[model samples]
Target: MSNVEIRPVTPADHSVWLQLWQAYLHFYDTELPAETSALAWQRFLDPTEPTHATLAWRGNQAIGLGQWIFHRSNWTVSHNCYLQDLFVQPDVRCGGVGRQLIEHVLTQARNAGSTNVHWLTQATNHTAMRLYDQMAKRSGFVQYRHAL
Candidate 1:
């Protein structure tokens, strides 16, 4: 973890981003369309796009990914950013890669005029929940999702 570095994701990072993204999918036991990944990668690099992400690098390897977006907030006094996806390779979990990625995102959000950053994770994701719970105050809110 000594050489781990977290930086904004760019279009030039397609291949390495793919590796970490695929590992994230494997962790959730889910399958995603390749086109969707490509689209996301492109959108992240588009400065006009609302959603952007950062990739964590450990030496020459991409180790983690985080996708976040900003929008007007009714709860907060000002706009805020929502972290949509955050994942790190299981082999290197809890080694500070994820933390660094999150911190970097926070910096980005602040630079974007966002007053707060928020995100959600599966309740069963104990390893991630541990880190998340310690980062910010956990509101007792429940989420409901409906698949189209």
Candidate 2:
């Protein structure tokens, strides 16, 4: 945890990012189509897109991934940052990697003049919620989605 560096993704980071990305999806017991994942990678690299990604590295190995987006919000004049995904390698969990990743996103959001940063986690993700509770206030709103 001491030497961990958080940096934005680059073209050469695809392999390691993909590995972490898939691991993240597996952690949620979900799988995305290859094309969907590839498209997301492309969007992360596209400057025109609001999507972005960063990786946490310990020495030469990637230990975590953070992906976020900036978008206009109805409640604020400035754009808001949505931390869409966060994942730390299982072996490195609870070693401050996840916190560091969230901090990285927060810094980036601030730099971009976003009003705030927000994210979602499953109700059962108590371990992560503990960390999140320390870092942010609970909005007390429930999320609902309608699948097409």
Candidate 3:
């Protein structure tokens, strides 16, 4: 983790970012439309958009990714940051890369005056939960969503 560098995604990062993005989706057994993914990439590169993305690199190889969005919340006057996605190469799991990526998002949210940062994970993702437990308290809120 000490040697890893976490930075905002750039146009030059498209190929590597797409590789990690696909892997992240596959990990959750989810499949999104290609156009949706393309749109997301475009949004990440748009400065005016609230969506943002970051990649963790070890040398020239990308090992992890963090994507977040900032938006208004009724719960507070300050903006809230939603950590929409987080992923690390399977081989690099538990080696602090994930933590570094999370910390990077947290720092960004703080700098932007966001009140808090939140994210979701499947209940079966116990390994990631172990690390998450150390970084944040459980909110005790269940999520219910209906697709349009």
Candidate 4:
């Protein structure tokens, strides 16, 4: 595997970011409305928005993507980082891109003075779980959602 360069998304990265983002949505068998996707991309570029995204590049090719948001936590005075999305190209899995993307988020969270960096995945996402197991402790809390 070649060296992977992970960096925050810039307007010039829109095309590559969309490719990775679409692949991520496909992996979960999900789809978002075109408007929603556009909004998300715009939010990532908005400095006032707490949402952000990063891409892992191998040479000129983008191989992974990560999206996170910062928010206040009732339990702490500092901000908390929620890693909302993570995906690595199928051919590059297990080659360290995913971990690098995650570490990028952690570093950003730390620099922002966030209390913690956290994420969630379905129980069936075994491959990612393996790496995650080595990176952080499980919070042991079940998530309950009330969607509008």
Candidate 5:
């Protein structure tokens, strides 16, 4: 962990980013259009885009990614950060990579004066939920969605 640096995602990281990005969607049983992924990569590079990405590195290699965005929350009357995607290489679990990414994002949200950082995961993803439960209180709001 000492060697790992969590920094902004760069344009050169596109190729590796796509593989991890796609894996994250697959793990959730979701399909993301390649074009959309491309747009997200581009958005990360664009200073004007609200999108911000952080990549975890152990020296020169990228092993994980966290994509986050900020928006005003009417309920909180302040901005909030949404950690839209977080994934670490399957081989690297329990090495504190995910925890570090989460902590880093939470810090970012706080530094931005955000009321909170939030995200939703599949209810069946117990491993992830367990970790989240430890970090924050469960909001207990049932989630529903319909794909058009």
Candidate 6:
């Protein structure tokens, strides 16, 4: 939509960012320590940090957020961009906000000379998988994690 704009998050965006961040976590039926969220917000503001964030805005209202990090990959000489989080407002789902936020990250990764941009979503999140399937190919690798 012409009215929608996506931009990097700024320090002044703390309040609005928190709202969207909370909504994102809730959508996944998860919760984090407040301090973890606080640290994430701080990371976005820290120039030296590899973590970055972008927000989708319709006029002055923040409608979505995309958080990503750049890291070295042994498979590639260039860094890989991992899109760690993405969320669109429930009221604004399917209105192209999510797509735009993802595209924003792709552009960022490209500009930063990243070899690829990748992320994982729950297999049950079929709605988002539809969009992702259209945009990128599946890696076909199952994920396994051992929580510390």
Ranked by lDDT, the better of candidates 3 and 6 is: 3
Candidate 5 off by > 4 Å: none
The runs of at least 3 residues in candidate 4 whose Cα sits more than 4 Å from the true structure, single-residue gaps closed, are none
What TM-score does model 4 achieve against the real structure?
Answer: 0.97
| Sort order, TM-score high to low | 3, 2, 6, 4, 5, 1
Error of 3 at 116 (Å): 0.4
Candidate whose lDDT is highest: 3
Best by TM-score: 3
Per-residue C-alpha lDDT of model 3 across residues 1-148, encoded as one tens digit per residue: 6999999999999999999999999999999999999999999999999999999999999999999999999989999999999999999999999999999999999999999999999999999999999999999999999989
Model 2, 19-100: lDDT tens per residue? 9999999989999999999999999999999999999999999999999999999999999999999999988889999999
**Any runs in candidate 2 off by more than 4 Å, and if so which?**
none
* Residue 62, candidate 4: alpha-carbon lDDT: 93
RMSD each, Å: 1.4, 0.6, 0.5, 1.0, 1.3, 0.7
Could you estimate the TM-score for every candidate? 0.92, 0.98, 0.99, 0.97, 0.92, 0.98
Which regions of candidate 3 deviate over 4 angstroms? Answer: none
Judge candidate 3 at residue 65 and give its lDDT. Answer: 98
lDDT for each residue of candidate 4 in 1-148, tens digit (9 for 90 to 100) = 4488999899999999999999999999999998999999999999999999999999999999999999999999999999999999999899998899999999999999999999999999999999999999999999999989
Candidate 6 has its poorest 10 consecutive residues by lDDT at: 89-98
Ranked by TM-score, the better of candidates 2 and 3 is 3
Residue-level error in angstroms, candidate 5, position 73:
1.3
Clashing pairs in 5: none
lDDT of 2 at 97: 97
The 0-to-1 C-alpha lDDT of every candidate, in the order given, reads 0.87, 0.96, 0.98, 0.95, 0.86, 0.94
Clash count (model 6, backbone only):
0
Ordered list by lDDT, greatest first: 3, 2, 4, 6, 1, 5
Sliding window of 10 residues with minimal summed lDDT for model 2: 86-95
